[model samples]
Target: MEEVDVVIVGAGIVGLSVAEKLSHSFDNILLVEKEDSFGRHISSRNSEVIHSGIYYPKNTLKAKLCVKGNELLYNFLEKNNLPYKKCGKLIIAIQKNELPILDELYQNGISNGVKNLEIISSKKAKEIEPLFKSCGALFVPSTGIMDTHKVMKKLEFLSEQNGVLISYNTEISAIQKQDDEYILSFKSDDFQVKTKILINCAGLWSDKISEMVGINSEKNDYKLLFCKGEYYKTTKYKDIKHLVYPVPDPKGIFLGIHTRINLNGELSFGPNAYYVDKIDYQMDDSYHQEFYESVKNFLEIDFDDISQDDCGIRAKLQKEGEKFRDFVISNEKNKGFPNFINLIGIESPGLTCCLSIAEYVEKIIE
Candidate 1:
């Protein structure tokens, strides 16, 4: 058996961020991941766009963390000599009726303390992005993109340098609280560990981890819905600068399928969201028409110009047609579990909010 002061389950960005930040104050800290390498799932997948804290409601964790995280992440990336671009973003309203949504987003963004969010006219938008089709656009200069893989690598390096032990290919089969410490059992290798503090940042399987520790998901409304979003890469559009997005559905459904530009100056559009029962990453060509139709209104592309590229699953707290739910990050002392912190339903902006989320958990513990 191994003994440690703190054990952080899941090596996703959120977990790794927490590990790196806490390593400064805590000793004998351990980070365990089921995968052989770090960030194989929710962390690596989806658009690598650095958000501007525009979409979330004011004073919510999503807005605050993302707004603060946006700055922290940029500084971290630059300070670490990582690759990134402040390419800016545009949320366009193709329909006249959607103009109000832009206003609402602008107001919400201003209230959330997002910097330099201006609703630009279609003429101004065309000056910035000539290929875009828009009636009006919310110009968010703070939004950008980064090398997510490199960012995670640096965090892992910093944590290890700070004396945090990260174990790969180790899964927590079961967890039980004995006295004040947590006893974690592994699936194989006859491995078990004990830690005084347990931090659950297990992105997709976080709810199951909580249940193992006797916190009911339904009772706490902490259940996660697996929303699968698929992307399509374009061979035609590479020079288009800035991230282009549609006005988000206010019903609090999914963000519409939008554009993604990687560091190589390649362009892709996608992540049409839908609910799924199981964890699956297999891309389906059956969505070719849907993908084309979704983007045709914003981008000029023939159906053949786009091809299925990749997909990722979002562990959302909101089910299909459910209203918005803020990220459920809490230290569950009131739930009779002290020294236990749970982070669930961290979806969009999780990447941008990774470091701030860690700082948030650090505040909870300190």
Candidate 2:
């Protein structure tokens, strides 16, 4: 069996960020991923939105880390010459009834310490985005978009250059805590490893990993609910300069389907949410009319203007109809697993919070 100082499971953006940050301090660090390449799942499939810490509750991990990560991400991107746009975002109210929700979000942003957030009138909203239809809008100036693939790749490179061994096409089938070290069973070559520290950064399968290590996922309330979102694109609505959003779900669930401009400067909309039972990436076009109906509340679009583009699944901790849940990150020593760290429910704002999440995890180990 191979021995290492630390072993991090999953090589998504969060895992890569953790590896990059920890490699400088620890030797013999190893990162393993089941996929043949990095960011093949949630990390790459997201809206790639650099969240502004607006929607999350104040002082929560999502809010604090997102705000801190926003600054860190910008600095990291600038230092590495990564491509990103500080394009700003709008959470709009299409009717008078929705104005209160916009104001509430503005207040939430303020409480969360999000800077430069303003509640703009429909006139000012039109002045900023002439095509958008809104009664009022919350302007988040710090919101932005970035090339997620580029960020993941750069983190991979930096970690490797710093002597962190990253193995692709590798999977940890099982793990056992043996006294002070964790013995990991892998898929290939009777491959096994013993690590003094085990960090579970597996995004979607994080709960299963926790189960393998003797933590009852259901009992611990660490179960992951798969909430899938679908997107659509349109060439007719060209030149969308910034993100445009509808008022969030009344239950504080999800931000409704909205418009997003990719890194290539193309206009697209979607990410209507629904719970799924399995992990499937098939794009369902059945909601074509529904998408049109929902999006027309905030933007002008013809029925024939859009087509199904892509979809992504979020490993949410909050079940349908449940209120917001914070990210689950902690050392499991009290749970009978010392030096074992688990990060569960790392969904949206995770990308924006990657570096800060890594820092938080590092502190846990220290």
Candidate 3:
């Protein structure tokens, strides 16, 4: 058996960030991932949009961390000379009935302390993005796009340079708490580890990881519902500039499918949401008509403009038709597992919230 001071599961951006931050404090740190490389799942998929903390409600972890992470992420990008674009974002209202939702988003952004949020006329919206159709829009200047792969790679570099050992293709099949240490069982039978502290950052499988440590996921409302989102791309991006969005789902199941611009100045649209029982990333044209109908309200394009691209699944704490659920990042001491931290339902603003999430977790250990 191997012993380490700390072990962090999941090598996604959040886990990598935690590793990099904690490396300065802990001499012995291990990061384990089931995938062959980091960020292979939720971290690498979907739009790499750096959010402006606009959509989340007031005072929640999503709101606070995202608002703070927006600043921290950009600072990290600039400080590291990473590739990114501060392209701004426009959330649009296509009809009079939707104006209230736009206003609601603006107010929420203000409540979350998001700066430079403005309710702009359709004219102003079109000026920023000529192909977009809107009656009114919420302009978020701080919203931007980034190369997530680069960001993850840089974090991986920093973590390694700080002497954090990352074990790839390693999966922890089971975990047991004995006295004050956690005994982790691996599927490969190659070796085992006992850590003084465990941080479960396994995004989609976080709930299952919690279960391994005697926490009843269902009893504690930590059950994760797999929500799958698929994307589409188009060459019609020639005129598209800034990021554009439709009013989010009122149930909060997702931020509505919107225009996702890449760093290359090309545009892709989609990530239409639906709950799924299995994890699958195989893309299909099943939602073609639905996507065409949705984004056509906000973007100018022919029905033939889009074809299915890639897809990703989110491990959300909110079940179908459920109310908004904040990110479940917490220490489980009172639940009887001291020094064990569980990060569940980390979706959306998670990319924007990575650094702040790391700081919050580090504080828990300190």
Candidate 2 collision pairs: none
Residue ranges of candidate 2 with Cα displaced over 4 Å: none
Candidate 3 ranges with C-alpha deviation above 4 Å: none
Give per-residue CA lDDT, model 3, range 257-278, as digits (tens): 8888888878788788899888
lDDT of candidate 1 over 71-158, digit per residue (tens): 9999999899999999999999999999999999999899999988889999999999999999999999999999999999999999
Which window of ten consecutive residues has the lowest lDDT sum in model 2?
247-256
Identify the runs in model 1 with alpha carbons over 4 angstroms from their true place: none
How close is every model to the real structure, measured as TM-score? Answer: 0.98, 0.98, 0.98
What's model 3's TM-score? 0.98
